[model samples]
Target: MGELFQEAILVSILAGMIRIATPILFAAIGELVTQRAGIWNMGVEGTMLMGAFTAYFIATATGSVWLAVLAAMIAGALVGLIIAFMTVTMRVDHFITGLGINLLVAGLTLYWFRMYIKGRAQPTFDGFDNVAIPGLSAIPFIGEILFDQRLLTYMAFAAVPAVWYLLYRTRWGLELRCLGENPKALDIKGLSVSARQYAAVLFGSVMTGLGGGFLMLGFSDRFLADITAGRGWLAIVALIAGNWMPRGVLAAVLVFALLESVATHVQVLGIDVPHQIFLALPYLASILLLMGLRRQSRQPQRLGIPYFR
Candidate 1:
């Protein structure tokens, strides 16, 4: 127990929390944008899985992580296009469309993976490494944990402010927020609701794809089935818990990641508790957090409602 409180161990846990939180932060922020635009996209899980698989396949094939990331973003954007077509153009039920996307992507990725591998040895590729900031990384406890991180981690944190500014300070952002709250108002003002929604969904999809790509390139060496491992769903939970705000979503992701990091260290310390319990700790914490914060969640007024001319 004392080892758990040691400075080194504590620092490791904090660093792990940041590392683990990266993927969720990206997905949650993306989803926040989608939701803010009045779209309830439940296909984030499927989009992430597809992104992960695409990144892994491209990296193994061409040995270019950059290409892999690009391919993954394109794949995600394609999926987002389908969702936009169904909900915005076809007027399909948002929930049904999103769930269908999830199911389709899951089955499709699994089948494609089996066919591609053909029982051969799984291919591996070099992944991103931690880059230490010259002076910042030298700080005793705070430096190593915060400054020395993968490039994707830095990008994820940077996105929080960027997203905030885009949503609150930009004209396009004003239109998007208006679309979510009342598409009719925007429509009356000669704005194109469908066009703005399409753009928002595409942007969100790209970010979600990048999140999945990072998971593959920044964390694991080889591709695994469902590598996203429910992080997409967790991201949605964080989005709701954060009440659809960028900074709030980040806080939610960090809390969940911190819990996960603690669970991981408990196993590392050889605690006598059931491993399953530790595995479930982060998820349980998410549920509890959501319940506590649900009342405060102020979703966009038109969220999940199909906007029509």
Candidate 2:
């Protein structure tokens, strides 16, 4: 009985780690694309909040998770457009533009959320159900941890490799990468630098939005203000610590997720320590990891510098 209980706890923790990874993983992977193209979008947190809010509103209003997801992607795209316009067209400082967007989104979402629930009880909706892969899901310990998850969870993992291929193997990717390393090179070749950057920013925002949508539809029943917490910031840190590589980003996200899972399980296990400490583990780890890894970062040379001409 003791051994069985231990195995169950282990499985639960690992499973929770994967589940927790989904949202940040999506954001990190998508941000990877944006960064590689030289746009350092700092509005990931606000964009994610908007996505979650959009998903929650659509899900509750229409009772359709898929529709909510679509809506979230749309919201993300709109945010991306704003970021692109500021950084690419208006030549605003990328950091300031991103921070401004974050502030704008935070306030906008709060006001909308308040109005949404005003004079009415908070609404809730059914979230996604896990789809256990046959044969794969039936295997021993590894199966459940790896194969039984919501559809979006599987998509998030798959996105790492897909993004890798897009970044490293494709022609469009080469041009996009050139935008980061040498926007002038693309300009000299008569390529449209601004167009590609806009696409990249939009892609990242849409994915971040999808991650937010999943954070809502895949986990929570209702929305709350600041529902995204700091996962968006974590995604940015993962990109830095991972040196902007897909595999490395995935590794960083998993580490953070594992810490979060441990934090979550601590309450269940009734550890005598303060839950706040556990809750702070991922952020603490992020600070430590960034300190160690920033020196090794292979960041784009032109990243965050607004391109001209």
Candidate 3:
């Protein structure tokens, strides 16, 4: 236990926490926006998987990380469009629509991957490299943990404040919040509820896609089925645990990531405990945390309720 608190191991754990939390941060913030607009997008897992697969495919085919990222965003936006069409335009049940989308994406990506690889060796591509900020990175402990990180990590953290400002400081945000609380009020003001919902869904989907892309390009080398591995679901839980606020969501993601980092280190330290317990710690913690937090959660009144104007 003393060795676990050593400066080196602590720093490594902090750094790992930040890296592991980046992807979840992206998805959680995006979901925050979606829910703020009264749209409960349950297909985040599918959207993320699609994004991962699309990014992997584009990178392997063209060898351009930038193009791959762009493609993944587009793919995610398209998935959002489908969700919007069903829930917003068609007024289908939000939960059913989202679940269907998840199933569709999961099956489609699996089939597409099999077809693309055709039993050949898995293709690999170069991923994003970490950028150490000049003066900041020179700081003893804080610098390496915060300043020396992948660009995506920086962007993910930066997004927390950006999302807060957007939700609390802007007219669009006001309308979005109102949509979740009372779409009728916004409609009485001559604002188009469906349009705002569509925009929110699209924005969230793009962010989730980018999260998926980063998960692949920044972490893994080769594409595999379900590479997201339930991170999207974890993001949703974080969003809920944080009560759908950007900063709260960030805090939730960080806590989950920290637990995951501790789990990894415990295994490495060869602790005499069941490895499965450590592996399951994050999810178990999340479930317990959510159960404790859900009663206190201040969800939007109209959340999961489709607005029919």
TM-score of structure candidate 1: 0.96
Per-residue lDDT of candidate 1, residues 151-235 (tens digit): 8899999999999999999998888998889999999999889999999999999999999999999999898887898899989
**Candidate 3: what lDDT?**
0.90
- Model 3 misplaced stretches (Cα beyond 4 Å): 290-295
TM-score of each candidate? 0.96, 0.96, 0.96
- Please write out the lDDT profile of model 3 over residues 197-270, one tens digit for every residue: 99999999999999999999999989888799889988998888787778789988998888878787878988
Clashes of 2: 0
- Per-residue error (Å), model 3, residue 273: 2.7
- Minimum summed lDDT over a 10-residue window in model 1 is located at 273-282
lDDT (0 to 1) per candidate: 0.90, 0.91, 0.90
Candidate RMSDs in Å, in order, are 1.4, 1.9, 1.5
TM-score winner, 1 or 3: 1
In terms of lDDT, the poorest run of 10 residues in model 2 is: 1-10
Query: Considering only N, C-alpha and C atoms within 3 Å, which residue pairs clash in candidate 2?
Result: none
